[model samples]
Target: MNSIQMDSDPIAVLMQEHHRAAKQLSLLEQAVISINVDGFTRHAFECIAEAIRFFEGEFRQHDKKEEQFLFPLLEKHQPGITREYRNEHRELWSAFNHLLSCVNDVEDGRLRGSSRQELVETATRIVHLLRAHIANENTILFVKAKKLFSTEEYKEFRDNVASVTA
Candidate 1:
């Protein structure tokens, strides 16, 4: 492969997704903070909705790519190192769902008292968890994959990632 192709391989694609997700998480955090303070202005609502949509769609697809295309090879090479990341994916999903629920409650005008608190807390949890999770994968898992995979293996990885559905 040429240098440009090498730079834009599967791992690089995943890293780009990570960067996008981190921005969405930041938007989510700011939206939640705005709602907590100002009771959901139009910009805050839009930001929250946009972030939720990204997570429900692209973020889920990103996770599927890792789980299906990347994790198996890592598991084959290192045995059990992928397990913690798998579990974290599940935890992140749970927290995201909780945040979604909280948003729904707010939309329904049910975000009073404890529900407001729950929304803030859930948003905080998902933001922190996802940020840390992304950082870990970038620094550790993807770095390992880059070092371990041969050129042929990377091509197969890229092909599989392209062919697989979320």
Candidate 2:
């Protein structure tokens, strides 16, 4: 929903969001590396904060668009596919919250020693998980959507996306 236009193709809108998420994940990975080498710094904290903001804000809305509008249609054609994506969504949400908690702890000076290591590990895990999840959606789910939806169906999907995102 960030910069996606209402008139744009819904699949393209989702793909744009995926690209944004990929960038944020990469930033998180870099922040973890920075923390490991130089310990906590403002830059590292900023990276974590940015990622948290994206997860809580734009990313959450994007997921809603998929879950409420996109996924159900896809589910009809591919019964179990939505289940897999939803499970991944839950896992990613949990992981993001955990990482955000760790970031908050670090920001407050409550995190130290092994806790910092744990934070780094958690961030790494999230980055990897999200990248893989995005890949799956881009390659499998989006491809299927393109093939399955009629023009009218795609327009309806777009309208639903606009209604939710607007």
Candidate 3:
């Protein structure tokens, strides 16, 4: 079973999501590296496709949970604390869109030869951006949330996240 499913604590569950994101990003990294070395193999294509699916679905949901539930509460506790994180979310979404377009171009046979670099660059951007964002959330935002949130607030967050993720 996934740690996200096992953990009742909302912060812990979010951390689990971060772990999953890290794994996916690692796959993307490996795929790009393989493309660079061996050219576009089926394995690389499958990895990139899997990454696209993940970012389109679970990644968006995770961000939505933070934006909707977590951010508001954090902002209430400390005004403007979440501003940078919100901005990063916007940036990540933009990169995700770019990556999607690049992947689509490859899938549709729109780009050849150059598609490798395009895919590598775009995936690198998203992977780096998201990894930094997750690091900040795990190290800073989530730490503050744990310290500042009341038990009731924590419960509400857990319940809200569970409802959405379920």
Candidate 4:
């Protein structure tokens, strides 16, 4: 679902990936909450693992495209705003690493009640942060990029995205 078709606009493709990431994060948040209420089970671990894998694979690629192509283009026009968004990306990455660590611990049979609680808390934070991040990028970043880039620049950016993502 994260795979974008060749004909689609690159910005639209990134937005679609964001939506998919949000859905996966919501699933992770719910799974963690369920584990907190009902205690950790194999199913919960599987869900968490799957979410982590999705992030590590597709989501990471999406992040790279933004960082490598989109952000730099935006930064040329809006350095302050781009810097703020890049900081947010760093924070999001830290949160993701925390969630990945928690999942690894669970897989290793270290699912204490406190650990489950931590997982739920971490996942909730990630879900909220990412939702906000996506909204900001969609509304502000992408909109500005669309308006600011010349036709040739936008085409080059889109082609770079396609090359990396393909």
TM-score of each candidate? 0.90, 0.91, 0.91, 0.90
lDDT of 1 by residue, 100-142 (tens): 8888888888867788778778888989998999999999999
Model 3 TM-score (2 dp): 0.91
The deviation in Å at residue 62 for candidate 1 is: 0.4
Candidate 4 lDDT, 30-86, residue by residue in tens: 787778788877777778887888989999899999999988888787677688788
Q: What is the lDDT of residue 107 in candidate 3?
A: 77
Q: Compose the digit string of candidate 2's lDDT tens values, residues 36-145.
A: 99988899989888988998999999999999999988877778778989999999899888888887787677957688888999999999999999999999898888
TM-score of candidate 1 relative to the true fold: 0.90
Cα RMSD of all models vs. native, in order, equals: 2.6, 4.1, 4.1, 4.3
Candidate 4: pairs in clash: none
lDDT score of residue 135 within candidate 2: 98
- The per-residue C-alpha lDDT of model 4 at residue 22 equals 85
* Candidate 3: pairs in clash: none
Q: In model 2, which residue pairs have backbone atoms overlapping below 3 Å?
A: none
For model 4 the local lDDT of residue 86 reads 84
Q: What lDDT does the true structure give each of the candidates?
A: 0.85, 0.87, 0.87, 0.84
